[model samples]
Target: MHPVLFEVIGLPISPYGLLIALGMLTGIWVAKRRGRAIGIPEEAVYDTVFWGVLLGFVGARIAFVLVNFGAFLRDPLPLVFSREGFVFLGGFLAALPVIAVVLRRWRVRYLAMADLLAPSLALAHAFGRMGCFFAGCCYGGVCDRPWAVRFPRIIDWRRGPVDLAEAEFTPGGAIYHGVDRVGDVVGSPAFYDQVKHGQLDWSDTASLAVHPVQLYDVAIQLGLFALLSWMWWRRRTLHGQIFLLYLWLYAASRIVLELFRGDLERGLWFGGWVSTSQLISGGLIVVALGLTLQRRRLFAPASEPAAAPRDPGDA
Candidate 1:
């Protein structure tokens, strides 16, 4: 996982930031193409996208800061200036109003536009999660097994320093270091040697093994995108149905994935059993279901009497 892509002279460029920008560009291009194919005006799509991107960024930053208020208070400048963490739900919520207003101003049908944008959103998320992987921030829990990777750079203060030596050395008729036999390095020559070797250390309180939630999200979003595309192409018969389906599907997948995420600052309902995201996902599911039912009822066809074409005779 290369965080810094390269250095030009003394300046460093972060790969994560670059990948995010690339994702945005790809999303915009996809949306434009989809809009054109669907007979939506290119200018209208651009206008809506501009507003959506702005609001999305603002919403993502705000949500991240609010969730980690304690950390932000300690480092205000980084919280305000750095573009590290982002919450997709926050951005989606903020962009909803912007998209609605744009659609209203242009006299466009909100449901049709939503259908066009759904796939683009999912593709954008796929790339964003890939960026997270490269940045090495959203890492998984530790395991000694083969599939379990050791992030050498990840330090834990509680564990002190890990000694790779097979045995501990005793000092002057007393046992010193390696007493716990649980990778805890107390005062010992081996510990000092590890420090000299530049091995990273961190607090033992930190969870070492965690699920790689980012990859899980990427898979779910990509699947959703495929499903949405199929629905959009096949079922343009009913307006807003595709969008409703998208909301329901994504919310359900997100709720499932939230179970694997261990970084939420606030636990919901149960003691450390539920997360804030799960609660939000539940709300989204309910709203999506209601919308789906409402759309079905509203778009249902009703019989009407045929009218005689006697306009010419009347005239």
Candidate 2:
């Protein structure tokens, strides 16, 4: 996987960051177009998209760092200032209340607005999954299938069993000078000819073959977007149902997809039996189910008033 897509002068353009930004822009554009079509004010769309994205990005970063607190504690600046490790669940959950507040303040129907935004969110997420593919985070468990991809830069030995001395002496493993098994090279060459040949790269990284979960995520999210869009088109008379359906479908999808995830930072409960996203998805599914049923009942045709009782004598 290519972490750094390229460099402009001295500045690096990360595919992860670039793609996330592009996805946000696309989502915003969709919201604006749909809001206008629904007769919503342009200002409302702008306010919601702008603030929601900003806050959501912050929330995503904060959630990721908090979940992986121990690692960040050692050297906090890299994670704090860098544009990686943004958790989608954190962003989605955080954006909901903010968007709700914005809509409520504007006196707009929150459910209708949510419906308009649902497909956009899915579309953006599809792109974000592509970003993850390039950046190599959110990787899946190792697999030997034909579709299983090998990320040459993402080695499997970062915190795994490592003998530094072996890395130094193993020809093309990694070179170290004045460090032992733990980077205490006694008298190894500072730079080997292979280093110039690009044999060794960013030291901590390792290469391993893993499932291409990113592609799987993209496929599912795009499919969800299409489904939501179609539902919105067909059920224009229905308010909130489309969004609820989206939540239910997306939550179900996330639960299944988390099973393939190999990243350790995503919280795992019950000794790794249930993932954090899976738990959230389960909760969302229950909530959406209840809301869907309730909303449908509220919108359903009322039962005909019971016929006026007639006195048996009169009959």
Candidate 3:
């Protein structure tokens, strides 16, 4: 995969980082526009997102490090500065409390703020998954389908994948461990697996065709974004319904998607029967259900309360 989108002034720019930045900026722009309609100050929205993003990055990085602790210990500097390895759930969990604090200090309704951010979160995640696809990270299990994608070899020698390309020299002063038979080769855990299982030979140019799970994740997130946006603008009745729905739906989808994931870097337990994301998603599903039930109790049908103030400036 084309990890480096391009070079600027002799420096490489990674597609993963660029796409994530683009997603964040787009999410912020959309949030600012929607925030105004619901009486949320633009400045408040900006402040909330800023702190959330800053903390989210740190949390994601920390989670990545913890998950790959042995590798981090062996090579700490590269791991710390690497553009890849961020976990979405970790960042999301870390950002929630800070977001809540900002909303409370700004005198904003928590549910309203949650609703406003829900679609934006899905939108951003869809873009981030697209970035993952470009970087060949979060890859999917092998598939015989016509749409399966065979990822390109890792050109960087530091990562330790077979270099099938007939390169005159190797990068980082690392010895070329590839056979002289010139051919294309796949990269990473896929390469390692193929070699171990005899699925790949030195003559191969790419990994075995596999399911494009990252694209599937992107599609799911976009669909969620569309549904949440529609609910936000048209069918929103209860204040917290959209946010709760987002949580429930995404958690459910993630459980299914994790089944197709090929990468083993994400933690697994119970003899690989349960993944970390799957376990987390299961808990989130229960939490969403409970919160939704509790939220519904606040709007009893027997004694309908007055309509909420259109402007929640002091809410």
Candidate 4:
């Protein structure tokens, strides 16, 4: 795992931030093409996606802070400005109403637009998950399997745990010191957990082997993108069909995936029986199912008026 992909003239370039930006651009490109195909103006696509992504970032940040309020309260500014901690479900939820408003103002069918954006969202999410892998965040529980990954420990003076091998560290902070755990040591959320619980130690070079949940998410998102694209092209029967199916399938996948997550900071509720993402996924599944059924009934091709009621006497 490598957080800082490289340095440009002494400025470290973060793979997490880079990949997210790439995902955004890829998503916009996809949305534009799909929009044009479906008669949506190019400008409208740009405006809608731009505003949605901007507000989505704000929402994701807010949600992450709220879930980890205790930590933020203890130390505020650094975490607030940190590049990590955005939650995807929070961003998606925030963008929903904003996109709806944009479409309604334009007098466009919101459901149709949602369908157009669904596959793009999935594809972009796949890229984001790839970023998560490179950053070594959102890791999975320990595993002895052949495919389990070992993240090198890399904690920056101000950034806490980083994924860089040559990250410069200065002497600071009471808990972490520059000279304490030196060299190219493996580290990540998984590493933090293992070290905290005595499963691993600072003296060890790499983290305990763990499941590659980030890659699992990447696979799931890519598969969902393909499935939604197929539905849009061939199997769609309603305006909201593709998007609703996307919500349902992605939510279900998240629910299953959450079980393997090792990052407890993401949020755990009901005595840690469920995660915040899992809870959101449950709600989305219900909403998707209800909307799908309602749309099917209300928007199904109007049937020919059931043959004139009897008409035997008239005949």
Candidate 5:
């Protein structure tokens, strides 16, 4: 809920963008602090996170647009610049090589560096899913369950994604105030007092009470973050195992969670029986398992007993 946190000098700074920025900042800060403990310089951590995040953000947005090309093709300018839609997998994978190069250039152990940053990445991603909850993009299927929640005015029957054809925007080219907010820009908070909340009266035209998969995503991702943090504290996992475990656990959870997802813009295949993320997750699971088998050691003292000369899959 609460997509638009508040207007900043008449420009709406969406909760989506704000939470993403916060996730990036907090994630980098935590990674940097952790980096210092392991002999990585603060400046190096800063640079690594900066370039990785920059590339990740751009890649995620581009991946979203690429998957939903039809929508972007009609009138792509607004969505192209807007900091709304993103694909986590795209962002995560996109940054892997960049971070690897950064670690190599900075003379840091690549696998260990990935292990150090894994927890921070999970934590940041958990927050980003919460941002999706606020924005109501990655919504879930309709349900009659007691906890099912509604997102009000998530779509306007009269108007499609954006009425670029009509061209009813402000003098400065911003979206008008009273237009039927469409596409991802719609969606009001789930909880609203009928008698007290006037601005939230979009319930009259709201989307049906659904599974609230976004909130479900938040819970699962937080669990993923916790698992990574716990594994890190244990310090018994293999040098690259932490990141591999992240991939495994995340893939496992996502495979299940994607079943409850409702928004259809995300790429799908096999007659909608499988989402793109599910396919990738399935592939990553095998990758994680293979790495685990190859390592044959988890609690080894010297990081990796015998690391591959150059394993890009370490991440």
Candidate 6:
């Protein structure tokens, strides 16, 4: 609810931006420490993170714009420049190639580097989701439960719950009018009461009462971070195993959590229930498994050792 942290003289400082910065800094710090422990050059880790951040930001914005192109078309400038709308998967995808190229140029083992980064990424995601919670952007639908958070101010925007008038269109192609007060029955009368009173009306909070999917994500990611850290600490006896396992774990969690994401309006293609995120998660799971299997084959020990080559005319 506290979107803005403080005002310096007259300028407002955003809590969301601050939290995101903190998360990034913490993630980088953790990665650098882990990198050194794993024998990676500290400088290379920093450079990789620098490029990763830049590429990740760009990729996240691009993905968000693509997904919500219709909304972006209405106001392109704000949509592009605004701090909101970043997708975690988009950032991860964007950073992958950038990190790979950097590692390749530096002659660093990409798989080992990825393993070091896996836990840090999850840690960062946990903080970033907290930022989202503060910003009220990636919000859950609604809830009447005890843990449910009611953000009245968030619904004041044209895209929020209070603006449900925009969601309803008449058969004659006219936009429906919003009631300035209670007693309106087109939608939920209880919702109308809450809107009019500037309070959360739990009676109509069904779809809105969806589980706090972001917190669920945070909890899952923290567990993943712990698991990856343990695997890395134990050295796993194989390169890339930790990274692949992280991917598998995260994808599985996402697939399950996406079920509670009532905010997504898109429907499944074949069945009654499915999500875009779930589709992506399934793909990631398959890719991770393939990579894990490939790593085992490539890094396996050789059956015999070859003799050193002898130079001509040399002893």
Superposed on all Cα atoms, the candidates' RMSDs to the truth, in angstroms, are 11.5, 12.2, 5.8, 9.0, 7.8, 8.7
**Model 6, CA-based lDDT:** 0.64
Q: What lDDT is obtained when candidate 3 is compared to the true structure?
A: 0.74
TM-score for candidate 2, residues paired by index? 0.77
TM-score pick, better of 1 and 4: 4
Clashes of each: 15, 10, 2, 5, 2, 5
- Of candidate 1, the 10-residue stretch with the lowest lDDT total is 300-309
Give the higher-lDDT candidate: 2 or 4.
Answer: 4
The predicted structure with the larger lDDT, 1 or 3, is: 3
Deviating ranges (above 4 Å) for candidate 2: 154-206, 297-315
| Residue lDDT tens for model 3, 1-315 | 666666689766777789999998899899899877767778888888899999999988887777667556655665577667788888988998998888767766767777888999999999999998887778888899998998754455224345443233233212121111112222444544454356776356677888899999999999999999998888878777788899999999999999998766577789988888898899999999788778767523312221233455654
The residue-by-residue lDDT of candidate 6 on 1-315, one tens digit each, is 445566679755656688778878888898888776656777778888899989998988887777656546654654587656687788888899989888766667777778778898898888888877666556554567788765442232223344433323221211221111122212222233344334443334422343566777788888988999998887566767788889999999888877766444222434637766677789999998787768767542222211122346532
Model 1 C-alpha lDDT per residue in residues 174-270, reported as the tens digit of each score: 1121111222222322222233233323222223444566677778878887888787677666656667777888888888777655443433457
Best by TM-score: 4
In angstroms, how far off is 144's CA in candidate 5? 1.1
Rank candidates by TM-score, best first: 4, 3, 5, 2, 6, 1
List the candidates ranked by lDDT, beginning with the highest: 3, 4, 5, 2, 6, 1
Model 5: per-residue Cα lDDT over 1-315, one tens digit each: 556666669766777788878887888888777766557767667878888888998888888788777657755764577557788888877888998878776667677777778888877887888888777677777679999987654333234222232232322332332112444344232322221124333324555677878778778777877887777767545667678788888899999999988666588899999998898889889988888787765434434432224445543
Model 4 is weakest, by summed lDDT over 10 consecutive residues, at: 300-309
Residue 183 of model 6 has an lDDT of: 22
TM-score on alpha carbons, each prediction: 0.74, 0.77, 0.83, 0.84, 0.79, 0.76
- RMSD of candidate 5 to the truth, in angstroms, is 7.8
Residue pairs with clashing backbones, model 4 = 152-186, 152-187, 153-185, 153-186, 153-187
What is the lDDT for 247 in model 3?
94
> Model 5: runs farther than 4 Å from truth?
154-204, 297-315
